[model samples]
Target chain A: MLLQQIINGLTLGATYALIALGYTMVYGIIQLINFAHGDIYMIGAFIGVAAVALFHQNFFLTLATAMLACVVLGVTIERVAYRPLRRAPRLNLLITTIGVSIFLETFMTVLKGPQPTGFPTVLENVTLRVGTLEFSSIQLVILLVSVALMVGLQFIVKYTKIGKAMRAASEDYDTASLMGININRVISFTFAIGSALAAAGGVLVGIYFNSVSPYMGVTAGLKAFVAAVLGGIGNIPGAMLGGLLLGLAEVFGVAAGFSTYKDAIAFTLLIVILLVRPTGLLGRPIQRKV
Target chain B: MEQWLSSVIDPYYQQVLMLVGIYIIAALGLNLITGLCGQLTFGHAAFLSIGAYTAAILTRDFHLPFILSLVLGGLMAALFGILLGIPVLRLTGDYLGIATLGFGEIVRVAFTNMKITGGAIGLAAIPRASNLINVTFFVILAVAAVVLLENSRFGRALKAIREDEIAAEAMGINAMWYKIQAFGIGCFLAGISGGFYAHLLQYLNPNDFGFLKSFEILNFVVLGGLGSIPGTIVGTTVLTLAPEFLRFVQEYRMMIYGLLLVLMMIFRPHGLLGGVNFRRLLRRRKQKATALSS
Candidate 1:
C-alpha cells in the first residue's frame, strides 16, 4: 500500500516539477514570478485536447503540438507584456504579469465556456505491474515523459551556448547585456523553454486526470509555485525536489484522511519552509549586507 | 449629505457606491503597505476575513452593539496583523508577498473548518447595521486618518524604509518597529473595511475573502498609483464603475482589467496620478514658460 502511494506521489510530483521549472527559470533570469505561466499550461492542455479530439492526432504528436504552440505564446507574452516594463519597477512588472494572467484566463473562458471539458483519451490505458505495486501504463508514460523532458531541459540549460548566455544574464542582467550577450534574446529563449516545459506538464496532467478547464491553471499553478518556492525560488534542482516532496506530503496527508484540508497542506509547508529556512533546501543562503 | 445621497441616487447605484466606499478603505490600507512602505502583500484579504468573523460572531452570538462590535473587530484584526508581521516582515519583496499569501490561505482553510464560523455554509443573519451614513462616515474618517498618518513622523519613517531599509536603519530609525506598525495600521483598515463588508452584506463566507479579492484590492492600488492617495481613490472608482457603464461588462470585467493592466504598465506605469491634476499642471507649465522667457 505504501509503495502504491509512493508511486502515485511520484507521478503527481513529476507533473508539478514540470510546471515548477517554468517559475524557477523565469525567476532566475528576470526576477519576475511569471504569474501567467500557469495559464500557459492551461492553454497547452486545451491545445492538446484539440489536437487529439478535433484533428485525431496521436499522443506524441499532440504533446509536441501543444508544446510548440505554447513556445510561441510564451515568447509573445514576454516580448509584449514584460519587455516594455523591463526597466520599470519590479512592482510594475509583477502587476503586468497578474494582468496577463487574468487576461489569459478570461480569454480562454470566453473561447471555451467556464466548464471543464473531458480530455480525449488518445493513449489506451493498460494495467502495468511492477512487482506487487500495480500501476497503469498512463502513469508510467507520464513519469517517463516528465523525466525525459526534465533531462533534456538540463542538457539544454547546461551544455548549450545560449544556456551560457542565460546563466550570465541571470547572474546580472545589465552586466550580461554590457558584455554583448544580447540579453533580450536570452530572456525570450528562457521564456520559450520554461513555457514548453509547463505545456508538456499540462498535457501529461490532462491525460492523467482526464479533464481540462480554464480555471485548472489557478490551483495547479499555485501549487507548482509553492513547489518552486519550497525548493527555493530560483533554484532549478530545488524546484524538482520541492515538487516531489510536496506531492508526497499531499498524497500521504490525503491518505491520512485530511482530505478536506488537502489544499491547505501545500500552503502550510510553504509558510513553514519560507519562515524557517527562507533559502530552501538546495538554495544558497542570501548574504545580507550589514 | 447622507440624506441627499440616499434620496438622489437609485437603489442599484446606492449599493455600488457603498461597495466602492468599503473598498476605498481596504485599498488605502493596502496602499500604505504596498505603495508607501514598499512591503507588497497579496494576503490583505486574510485580515479582512479576521475582522469579518470577529464582527459577525460578536454581533450575532453576544448580541453586542454594532458600532462597538465593529471597533473590536478592527482591533482583533490589528492584533493578528502584528502577530503575522513579527515573522513575516523580516522577508522583503516577492517573498513577503508569498508568505502573506500562505497566511491568507491558512486562515481561509481554518475558517472553512471551524464550527462557530459556520464551516463552509457561511454565517448569515448578522444585523443589517451598515448603511450609507455609517459607511460614508467611516470612509471620510479613514481617509483623514491615513492622510494624517502619512504626513506625520511615522509616515516619513515608513517612506524612508520603503526607499531603502538599510539607509533608514542607519538614520537612527527603528526599521523593524516602524514596519510592524505600518503593517498593523494597514491591517486595522482592512479589519474596519471587513467589518463594513460583513454588516453591509449581512453574511460572512470564507471563500469570499480569497486570493482573488486580495488581488482586486492590490489592482485598485496599483491602477491608481502606488503611494498616492487621490490616485488610489480614482483608480478604485474607475475600476468599480467600469462594469456598470458598459453592456455585458460583468462578463468581460476581468478580461478588460487584464488588458488595462498590460496597456497601463507599458504606456503609463505611473497610473492616473489623478489624471494630471490640470490646474497644478497648468500652473507648473506657466511657471516653466515664464522662467524660460525671463
Candidate 2:
C-alpha cells in the first residue's frame, strides 16, 4: 500500500516538476514571476484538446502540435506584455502579467464555456502489471517522458552553445551582452523552452486525468509555483525537488485520510518552510547589500 | 429637460452611485497597501469578508445596532490584519503576494466550511444599511481620511518604504511597525467597505469575496496611479462604470475589459493619471512652465 502511494506521489510529482521548470527558468533569467505562465499552461491544455480532437489517436502528432502552439503563445505573450516593460519597475510587469492572466482566463471562459471537457483517451486500456504491483502505461509513459525531457534539458544547458549562452545570460545579462550574446534572442528562447515544457506537462496531465478545464491551470500552476519556491525560486534542480516533495506530501495527505486538508497542508508546509529558510532549500541566501 | 432627468435617473442610477461610492472607498483602502506601502496584497477580499460577515452576524443574530456592527466589523478586520501581517509582512514582493493569496483562499474556505457563516448556502437578507446619503457621506469621510493619512508623517514614511524599504529602514523608520499600521488601516477601510456592501446587497457569501474580487480592487489601484488619491477614485469609477456603459457588448464585455487593461499598461505604463498628483499638476500648470524661456 505504501509503495502504491509512493508511485502515485511520484507520478504526480513528475508533472509538477515539469511545470515548475518553466516557472523557475523564467524567474532565474529575468527575476520576474511571470504570473501568466499558469494561463499559458491552461492554453497548452486547450491546444492539446484541439490537437487530440483533430488528430484522433495520433498521440505523437497531437503532442508536437500542442507544444508548437505553446511556443508561439509564450513568445507572443513575452513580446506583447513583457517586452514593453523591460525597463519599467517590477510592479508594472507584475500587474501586466496579472492582467494577461485574467484576460486569458476570461477569454478561455468565453470561448470554451466554463465546463470541464473530457480529454480524449488515447492510452485508456494500457495497464502494466508487474508482480502484485499495478500501474497504468500512461502513467509510466508520463514519468519517462518527463524525466527524459529534464535530462535532455540538462544536457542542452550543459553541452550546447545556446545552453552556455543561457547560463551566461542568467548569471549576468550585461556581462553576457558584453560577451556578444544576443540578449533578446536568449531571453526569448528561454521563454520558448520553459513554455514548451509547461505545454508538455499540460498534455500529460490532460491524459492522466482524462479531463481538462479552463481553470485547471490556476491551482496546478499555483502548486507548481509553490514547489518552485519551496525548492528555491531560481534554482532549477531545487524546483524539481520541491515539486516532487509537494506532490508526495499532497498524495500522502489525501491517501492518509485527510483529503480535504490537502491544500491547507501544502500551504502550511510552504509557510513553515519559508519561515525556516526564506531563501529556500537549494537557494543561495541573498543578503541586503548596504 | 429637468423633468426627463428626474424620471429616468432617480431610481437605479442612485443605487449605482451608492455602489460606486462604496467601491471607491474599498479601492482607496487597497491603494494604501499596494500603492503606498508597496505590499502586493491579494487578500483584501478576505478582510472585506471579515467585515461583511461580522456585520451580518452581529446585526442578525446578536441584534446589535447597525452603526455599532459596522464599527465592530472594521475593528475585527483590523485585528485580523494585524495578526496576518506579523508573521507574513517579513516577506516582500511575490512572496507577500502568494502568502496573502493563500490567506484569502483560507478565509474563503473557512467561511465555506463554517456553519454559523451558513456554510456554502451563504448568509442572506442582510439589513440594507447603505443608502445614497450614507454611502456618499462615508465616501467623503473615507476619502478625507485616506488623504489625510497620505499627507501625514506616517504617509510619507509609508511612501518612503514603498520607494525603498532598505533606505526607509536605514533612515530609522520602524519598517515592521509602519507596515502593520498600513495593513491595519487598509483592512479597516476594506472592512468598512465590506460592511456597506453587505448592507447594500442584502446578502453575503464566501464565494462573493474570492480572489477575483481582490484582483478587481488591485486592478483599480494599478490602473489608477498607486499612491495617488484621486487616481484611486477615478480608477474605481471608470472600471465600475465602463461595463455598465458598455452593456451593449454583453457577450464581449470581459474581452474588452481585458483588452483595455493591456492597452492601458502598454500605452500608459504609469497608469491613466500616474506620477503627477492632481493637486500638484494643477498648481504646476497654474505657474505656467516659466513661459518657456527659450
Candidate 3:
C-alpha cells in the first residue's frame, strides 16, 4: 500500500517538477515570477485535448503539438508584454504577468466554456504487478516521459552554448550583456524552454487525470511555484527535489485521512521552509540589491 | 442621521457607499504595508478573513456588542499579523510575497476545516448590527490615523526604508521592528474593514476571501498610486465603480481589467497618483500665487 502511494506521489511530483523548472529558471534569469506561466500550461492541456478530440492524433503527436504551440505562445508573450517593461520596477512586471494570466484564463474560458474536458484514452490503463505491488501502465508512461524531458533539459543546460549564456545572465545580466551576449535572445529562449516543459507537464497531467480545465492551472501553478521556492526559487535541481518531497508529503497526508487539507499541506510546507531556510535547500544566499 | 440619509438618498446608494468605504479602509491598510513600506504581500485578504470570522463568531455566540466585537476582531488579525511578521523578517521581495501567499492559503484552509468556524459552509446568522453610520465612523477614523502616521517621524522612517533599506539601517533606524509594526497596523485596519464587511453581509463564507480578492485590492493600490492616500482612494473608487459602469460588458470586465493592468505597468508603473506628489504639487501652486502677486 505504501509503495503504491509512493508511485502515485512520484507521478504527480514529476509534473510539478516540470512546471517548477519553468518558474525557477525564469526567476533565475529575470527575477520576475511569470504568473502567466501556469496559464501557458493550461493552454497546453487544451491544445492536447483539441489535438486528440479534433485531429485524432496519437499520444506522442498530441504531446509534441502542445509543447511546440506553447513555445510559440510563450515567446510571443515575452516579446509583447514583458519586453517593453524590461526597465520598469520588478513589481510592475509582476503585475503585468498577473494581468496576462488573468486575460489568458478568462479568454480561454470564453472560448471553450468553463467545464473540464475529458482527455481521450490515448493509452489504455493497464495495471502491472511486480512482487506484490500493483501499478498502472499510465504511471510508467508518465514517469518515462518526464525522465526523458528532464534529461534533455539537463543536457541543454549543461552542454549547450545558450545554456552557458543562460548561466552567465543569471549570474550577472549586465556583465553578460557586456560580454556581447544578446540578452533578449537569451530571455526569449529561457521562456521558450520553460514553457515547453510546463506544456509537457500539463499534457502528462491531462493524460494521468483524464481531465483538463481552464482553472486547473491556478492551484497547480501555485503549488508548482511553492515547489520552486522550496527547492530554492532560482535553483533548478532544488525545484525538482522540492516537487518530489511535496508530492510525497501530500500523498502521505491524504493516506493519513487529511485529504480535506490537501491544499493546505503545500502552503504549510512553503511557510515552514521559507522561515527555516529562506534561501531554500540548494539555493545560494541572496545578495540584496543596493 | 439615518432617517435623514434615507429621506435624502436611496438605501441602495447608501449600501454601495458603505461597501466603498469598507474597501477604502482595507485598501488604506494595504497601502501602508505594500505601497508605503515596500513589502509586497499577496495574502492581505487572509487578514480580512481573520477579522471577519472573529467578529462574526463573537457577535453570534458571545452576544458581544457590535463595536466591541469589531475592535476585538481587528486585534485578533493584528495578533496574527505580528506572529506572521516575526518569522518572515529575514525574507524580502518575492520570497516574502510567496510566504504571505502561503500564510493566506493556510488561514483559508484552517477556516475551511475548523468546526468552530462552521467549516466550509461558513458562519451564518451574524447580526446585522453594523450600519452605514458605523462604517462611516470607522472609515473616517482609519483615514485620519493613516494621514497622521504618514506625516509623523515613523512615517518618514518607513519611506526612508522603502527608498533605501541599507541606508536606513546606516542612519540608525531599526528596520525590523518598524516592518512588524507597519504590518500590525495594516492588518488591524483590514480587520476593522472585515468587521464591517461581515455585519454588512451578515453571512460569512471561506471562499469569499480568496486569492483573487487579494489581487483586486492590489489593483486598487497600484492603480491609485502606491503610497499615496488620494491615489488609493481614487483607485478604489474608480475600480469599484468600473464594474457598475461596465455592467453591459460583464463578461469582459476581467479581461479589460487584465489588459489595463498590463498597459498600466508598461506605460505608467507609477500609477495615476504615484507621481502626483500632492503636497509638492500644492506647494508649487502656492508659490505660483505668491510670484504672480509680487
Give lDDT per model, in order: 0.89, 0.85, 0.90
- Candidate order, lDDT descending: 3, 1, 2
Docking class of 3: medium
* lDDT of candidate 1 over A1-290, digit per residue (tens): 99999999999999999999999999998888888989999999999999896557599899999999999999999998999999887778888998999999999998898999989888899998878989999999999999999899889878999988988888888899999998889999999999999999999999999999998998899899999999998888889998999899899999999988988999999988988988777777787664
Error of 2 at A106 (Å): 2.6
How do the residues B129-186 of candidate 2 rate in per-residue lDDT, one tens digit apiece?
A: 6777777888999988888888889999999999889999999999999999999999
Candidate 1 chain B: 10-residue stretch with minimal lDDT: B273-282
Looking at model 3, residue A17 earns an lDDT score of: 93
Which runs in model 3 stand beyond 4 Å of their true positions? A288-290, B288-294
| Docking level for model 1 | medium
* lDDT, residue B186, model 3: 97
Candidate no. 1 TM-score: 0.94
Chain A TM-score relative to the true structure, per candidate: 0.98, 0.97, 0.97
Off by over 4 Å in 1: A55-57, B1-5, B247-250, B274-294
Model 2, native contacts kept: 0.29
Q: What TM-score does the A-chain of candidate 3 achieve?
A: 0.97
Cα lDDT of model 2 by residue, A90-207, tens digit? 7677777877887888888989998999888766657788877888888898899889989988998899999899888888879999999998898899899889889989889998
